[model samples]
Target: MAAVGVGAFALALAATWTSGPLATGIGAAASAVYALVADLLQPSQRVHAPGGALLRTAAGRVPRFGRLDRPELAGVHPADGPGDRRAPPPYVERDAEPSVRRALEDGGFVLIVGESTAGKTRLAYEVARSRFPRHAFVRPMDRSALAPAVAVARRRRRAVLWLDDLENYLGADGVTAPMVDELLGRRPGRVVILATMRSEEFRRYDAREESRLTGSDRDAWRVQRDVLNAAVKIRLERHWSEAEQLRAAAHREDPRIRLALESGDRFGLAEVVAAGPELLTAWQNAWAPGANPRGAAVVAAAVDCRRSGLRRPVSREWLQDLHRPYLAERGGPDLQPEPFAEAMAWACQAAYATSGLLIGNYSQGYTAFDYVLTASDLPPVPDHLWDALLALVEPADAYDMGLVAHQAGRLPRAAAALERARAGGAAEADFLLAIVTGDRGRPRHAARDLLRVVERRRAALGAAHPETLAAVHQWAFFTGESGEARAASAAFVRLVADATAALGAEHTDTLAARHQQAYFAGEAGEVDTAVRELAALLDVRLRRAEADHPQALAVRRSLIWFSSLRGDLAEAERELRLLLTDAERALGPHNPHTLAIRSTQAAFAAQAGRTEEAIAEFTRLVSERSRLLGHDHPHVTHSRLQRVQGLIAVGRGAEARGELTEILEEARRVLEPGHRHLVLARSLLAPPRHEP
Candidate 1:
């Protein structure tokens, strides 16, 4: 299709030699077509590529486009006008408030979305006002504005990035794509990017690009999706009840009225909001040919539900043919736009609201891009349309769909999609299937699947390929989980050597392989050698990488365990503190990595005879870990065990025994019987025997 576009561009170039309105339009349209294809052909950024020492050392000094153009004072809210100094409006409780607060507190990101009238911006301000009372509310409308905001936030050590109508700035090829990327990529916990966009707009931004992607700069959606997958999504209900309508009318008064009346209140975008969360079908029924704003949405939604990601879009001719029948069935062919073409023209206008386009050309039919509609959506496709499209295309481009679903943590949907991919002979899906299976607690099956990938890729891509080696390493990992520590250990040793020889000693894969080798070696009972090897790896890493680089932090992490295993409690304590400091500095105090290190810090403190401090640390870790990783996760279980040990250490044996009893039951339920923590818990809780 794009090749055809290129050919059309050549014809338009020639036509431009003759000056006329038709020629001008043709030339401009052809250039756009060519540009779209050119954008598609651009290289995908390697976001996951490892950063080296230079980048790490220059972290704080790196160029930043994350700052806000106008940063509000944290200490004081600007008076609206004429000394109308006042408190913000009271927050209306919503289903998403808890989740929004949690995401903000977690120091990650959140995207609030709804229709124009859904109060998305209001929700964002309320959230910030509630959670970040002491920090500035920084909002940026353009990419350039982000840098100043980020700069202030970083300097202050905290700030809320209040981005309203996010699509205006971060949409595909928007002016501030680089700035948005920089803000999202580097800010982490230092600055929280709380952005709002209409769901309709957001859904459209990547609908076309993602569906037809050959690989390109337009893959920003992929990055944004991945980043925001970690973020909390607060989508205001698209369905508006009568009660909500009344509340919006009564409470959301104009800012000017409040200012003149000397009432304390923050200005809101309420007046700009259009009413009605009307169903799409109803909207379409109501729409007429004369300047109907809903035409594009109707078209976008129709395409979303009808087009399969794997197939070429339905041609304009095909759409017209189908739409004619659709209108007839609704008994509304006489509604307003007598001709199907006129209705389609309206659709083109409405579609600008979403990330959708109606491409028309002499040679090809109109096509839809990345719009997706599901049964859950307000404007979901009617069953007849869905059935037609189902027959028209393959179920989906399952692998691509599965990858996106997996990243979004939609496990069941991911599995269903990948199952289709596997049926279609895509080997990549199997690898993710294995991960999904493991997460579902089917380790045996997952291990078998992973091993198959490793063997297959090793033969096809060669042992030296980074992907093949990664598979081997992952297979070895699941091999351990599926119960073969010694074999897995041997495999890791070989992988480390192979990685070093093929990729060079300083390669990220080699470093990761070495780290794995050290752990498995210890598990295989080569504790002394493992300790020495880990210490040696740490030395090499510290020399080559930034002191707090993730790899170096990982190395120190392993050494702390080795130090403990070697019975050097003081050395272990020192390493734990060092690891904790680095982790806190690099990932933030509340980061999962930092929290894990904190647990180890407690264990070290306990072993070093800091009884009171150890108990406090362990208690903190147990509660935090439970909240973060869940109670059944191994990390939480292990932390609990350490807490038990601390109780025993303090001669609170009865309390220790009681805690062990609870842990023993929990271990039996959540862990394998022979699991190290399970075994330890059993021994600790075993009843004392009296001499017979």
Candidate 2:
């Protein structure tokens, strides 16, 4: 009985041990079953990978499975080597062409030139393989490595030496006369040299050499045409013939080709042909049955158009017209649903790639195209796919859209997009939301949200990140604008210090911080300190950013106002006139900032006994302001008060009194009685009793 009990316990222990793995296996099997069910449930939304099998097969064929066997060549082809048993270079198939073969075999030196991405590097590889089948094709390891490469070539009795992207290592900085001399002086029998370079790179090399190809001037090609003239030069132009296009289309299995051919819209056929065979092949393969070919054709068309110099963000009407016939041809107005969807997707991608030319910061004006590209492929989407969509969307508009929705009290949509952006780890989204939450009239609850965004951004993007720094500056500016002077001052001080350190003391960001610091310092009751800071910042900006630059002009205007506050009217007028002229030139007439600066100058002139000049300036300013910003605007009221002061300065007491009364009435109507401008107008009227 004891033996049987012990056996039972052992059997139970064995079952327990096996149960964990069995449960894992069952869980994995269940997951697979669910995946299949999910896939079947959504046949319309599936992603297929075609080259995956081929890539896996190629990966397996690699000798070491994952790592390259030779350390010197790393994981690239063995022919791309410098340190192994100097084996012969790999032969390129293009060598089968007699002219190219003869050039590689007999030419003293060869200069391979082509545009970027024009197969120049591949051609160089082929040349190395054919010329030195038994010798290892060693490439220059670095700018310093060129010498060692030359030495190795000398040691090997017969070798084919290739310099891939040689222009990068042989331009002005990369080349020295001594290096070239050494390379050229080496025996021709032991070393057959070849180098690949772009057209622009060749120009730079020619410039350095002062007009000659130093070592082997006998074998140089100015243009791709020059290569064609050579016994070995092979020019690979874009495939344009119908046969070539058809072959490419067949390779890609793109159904659109048939549709396009059937549609008979031939206006841009030449442009389409110039996109090259490889692109056509890619589209065909991507669009074949079972392949989603989402935006392949659209992207291909856009790329083709751009190469032909037609700016991107092609009209939707143009794309529709181009693809309509193709669609009609495929199924006579009943094309397969999947293929139709794929064609639209391709067009959207093309539209995005060509839109606005990737300008600085924002993509200027392709809103329609970006919208279509972003809204596709949702639900169980890959992270990279989501990121690619976002990258194509303009950030400023995305921010503005979120803000507009938030301001209109459309919280759900705003929150949804913001949450999506946040989940996707976008720093700009957090910064923009922080701005929205901190704005006046927002609920007190929003402050916590703003702070949360601020904290998250600081953590993710770092304290000195440009966007993070801008957000912090905005927070401080908003605090000051909203009447929290102390908090604003503290925030400004920290921001100024950080910006000064990170951007360098003289950087534009540092100067902007200093300008804000000056403003906030005055607001916080440090007027004298503010004046000193503004003066220094203005001087630095004038010298560095140029006096006419917006930042420098702004700083100068600030200095003028600070000077007026300190009772320095003469200095204020001097600074004001200089800023006004520059502002007029830079910002144009009727700009609010320019008008404000002019008004400040008028006040300074009135204080300095230049009444006539002040009255003329003020009258013009008041008229413009009344026309531009209504008669009741604060700036208009301010201009009226300046005119009254100018009249008083010239002893026109009656006119001054009348002007002051008008200014007071306007101020009373547009501003509070105790407001600074109203008080100033009342005081100016009190001083005058003399008639004109």
Candidate 3:
């Protein structure tokens, strides 16, 4: 018991530290004196030993540790999780098996932690088969039914909770959230918790979870800490010894292969051991006939929605559309219904892989990783990623793929893919196209899409539904951008009223609508109203949000612009400098918001006749933006044009003309024909192209 208990929670050992010394050993007389002292000094000094054969006690008998060395564990193949029809044959006992079994014996919670695909699930299966024949596997996607699941498990002779992906479960169904509480509430030997957590998710588990705790949740918080502290943590490593690798392949003729694979940094072998040489691809082939179209579509959708360290939601409808062509087989002259069983089989396999990329729901799909697992594991993006995406995805799924490109600002790729989507009966892609239109500097065109989005949502959902109101608010905001300031102001005024009444005034969406309404007042020639409303809003924003919140910084930018308009150059300059410094610190110098501020500062300098200073600032802005957002991007071109203006202001019109010609030519090639920057550049080239 002692040998198996190595590194079993340091806190437990610490608790026992003074107890031995405190219990003075005259057997009876000294023990009585010690008891009296303990009662006087520490009323809470009672230590309950864990339930184990070893009397650590106030515990039930500790279960015996079964034999855990190689003989029982070794097999030629991989093991299956619960209910697997053909779990690969169990392999040589993982070194982790003993700890897992021992941890379960002492019974509270055991976390099997490891990197993605690092054999955590495989080890778990071995532990479950050897120890717990009846256990409940709790998953995040099935969380709504979690209470019934635990209730069912608790009915059994020996209930074991098999929880995997603890991080996702933190915010899942009700029972899953009270996981630690439930574990501690149970009698130790009566129930045991076996769980696995990806190391990265586990590292951030507290951040995602702890914030939800209210001030009134002190007891829950304490129990959570105690549960985590009491958990027997087994961290699985990716390394395998030369002997083990060779022995794993003992039936093979290759002698040197195992040695080479076991050598330095062979991450590939970990994937092989965990899922096979083609971990993810193997599933596709294995489930091909059963899930011909469904699984592939799900995989593609997941691939398209990859985000960084955050799960992106994908709709089930989009996945269904992708699955259509394969199901119906129109080209084959036969219209057939989708094979419900086949699609379901794939869905089950995908969602149930010990730590699969996707977690399925009837209405949606979720990836535990922000990016597709395979793409994330690859080398850094090559220069031609756009080309790669276009080549990799099918034409039918191109709209979803295009939405990814559009949202990410890959305009050229976004344009092509979106055009394909629009052609393919994907009406939703039109909304994304509108956003792309606005981004490409044709706000009026974007306004049309925004209107459609608002109308469609308003007609389908009620006017006060959050999604409908959100769409309305977006339409309202777009009017100001479309150069309809008076219309924008009126729309926002109505929006602010609607949002404030429906949602509370302090809600983020309401506040934003209020802020934009205030900004629209200025654009509509109500400067005093804009100034007063923005000033009050800025104070509230600064108080409510973080120090450098985007809204507050935007408010500061407005104040500087309006103050500059009122000819308060000194005040405007001072505030702009502070805003620039704070913005740069908060959101790196090359961030789009920070660069916008820089452009504003440079324009202010030029307006103030600080020609050289403006030129210097604009030069740096152009160079930094070109690096941050490619040379042909509108952001860089705008800065380049501003720098050209600064040059012309300093009596370098000849040099300005040269730079202007290059920018205009690039604008002609890369930007929309009537894009604002192109219009600005052409105006600068007109007669009386005087310095600003």
State the local distance difference test value for candidate 1. 0.54
lDDT over C-alpha atoms for residue 453 of model 1? 83
lDDT string, candidate 2, 577-638, tens digits: 77788788876676666887888877677767778998999999989977654566556777
RMSD to the true structure for each prediction, in A, is 18.6, 21.0, 19.2
CA lDDT of each candidate? 0.54, 0.47, 0.54
Q: How accurate is candidate 3 locally (lDDT)?
A: 0.54
Q: Runs in model 2 with CA error above 4 Å?
A: 1-452, 605-692
Clashes of 2: 19
lDDT winner: 3
Superpose all Cα atoms of candidate 1 onto the true structure and report the RMSD in Å to 1 decimal: 18.6
Q: Give per-residue CA lDDT, model 1, range 1-692, as digits (tens).
A: 76676856754653443323222222223433443444335223211211111110011332122221111111111122222222333334555667778877866567887654445655566666657666544544233354565565556556666555554334222224345456656756667777776665566443232322211111213434444444467777644444544444454464432432232122122321211112233344444444332343345444653232322334444465455445544445344444444455544322322212343332333444222232244342344553344344332345544554443334445566677777777536677667655543345666688788878988898878766777777777766665677887788889888988898997766777777777778878888878888888888877875576655676687777876887867777776777787677776676555776787777677766798898888888888766544566566778888888888878899999888888877667645446667778877878768899
TM-score of each: 0.45, 0.35, 0.52
